[model samples]
Target: MDAKAWDERYAGTELVWSAEPNRFVAAETGDLPPGRALDLAAGEGRNSIWLAKQGWQVTAVDFSAAALAKGKLLADAQGASVEWITADLVTWTPKAEAYDLVLIAYLHLPEDEMQSVLAKAAHSLAPGGTFLLIGHDLANLTEGVGGPQDPSILHTPDKVSAALPGVNVTRAERVRRPVTVEGEPREAIDTLVRAVRA
Candidate 1:
């Protein structure tokens, strides 16, 4: 979906996603000391706001102005300060070697675009900075639940790992997440990758 589509989607009375940070995001970053962080494609600022409360100076970027506005409202309500930027992630570049932590969650794109964005994210990290990413695994399409069905946009751990050329990969694998579907419990697969710039 483009920015306009996303804006319309977020305009509904109900929240599209929960205000809490993604489970993988909280788990992967909970122990890290506070530092400058970037949340790319940060829809509604969930992770960005959570990071701010954790003492990290955060900048959250997303293309939808409506989404950003909603995020700003939530941030204000929570007393968490976050810099929300409205721009396309594909065109918006972060300062090189600036962020201590960079996060990308569920930003699905074609393989080439995904690689390009991941490369940019890796290069934006300072030496020793941590980069964490999570998204619906390609296997989620058939063997799991919830996510885009298009195979081109879905990704695998190996594919994601290959995109980060200059990083030491700490964790790059498909992980299972428990979810309830129509009152029945099931597992959803996701690709989780954590790396540090060398």
Candidate 2:
């Protein structure tokens, strides 16, 4: 979907996504010292606002203006300050080595575009900065639940790892997330990667 489509989706009276940060993101950053953070494709700035509350100076970028507007209200309500930018993630470039952490969550794109953005994310990280990505794994199609149906846009550990050339990959694997489908409890397969720039 394009920016216009996403705008329309986020223009609803209620939020489409939860206000909480993703579990993987919280788990990964909980122990780190607060610093400058960049959240790409930050839909409604849920994670961005969470990061701000955690004492990180956060910049959240997404293509949808409506989503950012909602995020601004959310941040205000939570007493969190976040800089929200309306731009295309695929083409947006961050300031070189400016962020102490870079987060990309559930931003599915074609393989080439995904790689390009991952490279940009790596470039945005400062020395010793962390880059973390969490998204639907390619195996989620049959082995998991609730994700984009298109396999081409789905991610894998190796795919994400290979995109970062100058980083030490601390973790790159498929993780299981418990979810309820109707009434039966199930696990959703997700690809996750955590890397640090040298």
Best model per lDDT: 2
RMSD of 2: 0.7
- Candidate 1, lDDT over the whole model: 0.94
Which portions of model 1 miss their true places by more than 4 Å? none
lDDT of 1 by residue, 1-198 (tens): 999999999887667899999999999999999999999999999999999999999999999999999999999999999999998988888999999999999999878888889999999999989999999999999999998999899979899989997899999999999999999999999999999999
Name the weakest run of 10 consecutive residues (lDDT summed) in model 2.
84-93
lDDT of each: 0.94, 0.95
Error of 1 at 17 (Å): 0.4
Give the TM-score of each candidate: 0.98, 0.98
Per candidate, the number of residue pairs that clash is 0, 0
What's the CA error at residue 3 for candidate 2, in Å? 0.6
Q: Please give the RMSD to the true structure for each candidate, in Å.
A: 0.8, 0.7
